[model samples]
Target: MSARPSPIFRNVSSKVGIIAAFTALNLATDYMLTGLPNVKFMDAFYFIATFEFGLSVGLPVVCFTRTAYAIVNPLGAAPGFLIVFLVVGDSMYVLSGYLSRTFRLVEKESSAGDRVLSIGLIGLFSALGFDLITNFGTGLSMVGGSGLQSHLWGALVFGLITMNFPLPLGIVHEASDFLFFSTLVPSSLALLSRSGLITTGPLGRVIGKRGDNQN
Candidate 1:
């Protein structure tokens, strides 16, 4: 009989599976909330991925999920570069999550108030960052052939115009991200940690219990 794959291989396989599952679920949730008022889970899900998987895995998965979702997106993927812009926005969430871990910016284990406050701060900044990245991408795409100064001016102009969509919608989305992240992230990390599917990293201590990165 063929020898079973080594424990390391099995572990890596499982992590990939978890990543794929989470990505699918995130997209599914977005689809379900399609008609809701800024009720999508994209930012919150990215926080979970980065919290569970870190930058190396989380960032690539964000890129993949955004691109895949865009390709097969049901509501029609208009503006062709929407996927790229969304990926850029999702990357902000991943980077924000990783930065928290890297700086020990968020509490690992603390009071509910403290944890909520810390995560809220992260979510707030992440929302703003997401808006900036995606809006900036949208802006750049519109002025691709312009000179550097014009490009800069165009980006700023378009970014604001883009952000004006149902202005309060942005606030609602940020609030949703904070609520979900505060309530779900720590618990998910613990459950996945118990399952031995995720690992801690040097700069970012996730679980900080069992395994480290396979790569």
Candidate 2:
């Protein structure tokens, strides 16, 4: 019998490839969308993680992607703001991914009613959570004293608007996410079918069985 690949080896190779690809994709998209400050596409990566890879993968992926972006951008006049952005942004994405996964709201196979409820709740919670956490962090890191109040108000307004309306940047983020998942999920499902992990069937019927027992 041929020797099997060690689990550690297989896992390392698989994760390395996946993470590298994801990082490249994240960077490329950020670059392409840089001209349009009103539009951000990297949010799609987080959405994809939540939907496809589950919390464990999604959380780290979001955090790392945000950290990478911060490393590249180095935002704000103060270096401290840059540091806070990295930490706070990463934390927000991780929280969003974990919440989405825990709530089972981002599941691809959810019903319409479920979809509406899940997406609405998840969006509200995520937007608010990120806004609160990041605002506080930003205030602490960059601004001082009464700046916290201003930041809090800003977060609340930004969170409410972005979560509810189609702000230009938010639109781009959501559209990219929808497009990415629309393509990726079908391909994944197809691969699963071919690999015998899943099977297609008629409504209310199982595959591989020619049944006429509707009596």
Candidate 3:
């Protein structure tokens, strides 16, 4: 006669497995796409994990993936300060995912265009926040000394304006995130739903499967 647990809390070991799987996937994708400069799918995976499984699964995945990638990057390990910023910046996707789930931003009943728009907006804003925070952190790490405040502000501005310069790395980063979020994330969810794996969370509406069957 005990009350049933929420679906999110029902599968502890499976959820842990999911966390490890996502972290590994993020790291693999980051390494595979290292040459692309800012074009990584980490954000999309972070958002998808969070949106589907909630903060518990998302936080560990984000933390482990970002930390591992920063310390063992193909381009060389990031500095301690930069690594901290990278983790913090990437955590924004967790917040974005939580908000998206809470608000049911990408409901199963929504039209394809609407779903795309919702996920795209989330991706766009989350990417912007990630870029700003990490770029500022990059700037701060690059500058130091007497006029720290002024120098920090100047560096932040410089980082933003010239982030891509002749190459447009910044644009590639944001655009790729939007593309991945809108298409891949939802498609992944749908695939899971079709495979009968997604039976909970906001995505429960997918393929008309409800989370209500649980006792």
Question: Best-fitting candidate, measured by TM-score?
Answer: 3
Answer with 1 or 2, whichever has the higher lDDT: 1
Q: What digit string (tens of lDDT, one per residue) describes model 3 on residues 98-159?
A: 87777665674358898887898789888888888888888776666478678888779867
Say what the RMSD of model 3 is.
5.4
Q: What are the Cα lDDT values of the candidates?
A: 0.69, 0.48, 0.78
Per-prediction RMSD in angstroms? 7.3, 11.1, 5.4
Candidate 2 per-residue lDDT, tens place, 73-161, comes to 63423354555554565455445555554554356545755554445444444444554555444444433345667766665555545
Best of the two (1, 2) by TM-score = 1
Clashes of each: 0, 0, 0
What RMSD does model 1 have? 7.3
- The stretch of ten residues in a row with the least summed lDDT in candidate 1 is 1-10
* TM-score against native, each model: 0.77, 0.53, 0.84
Candidate 1: regions farther than 4 A off: 1-10, 108-110, 141-146, 194-215
Ranking by lDDT: 3, 1, 2
Instruction: Report the Cα lDDT for residue 207, model 3.
Output: 19
Worst 10 residues of 2 by lDDT: 1-10
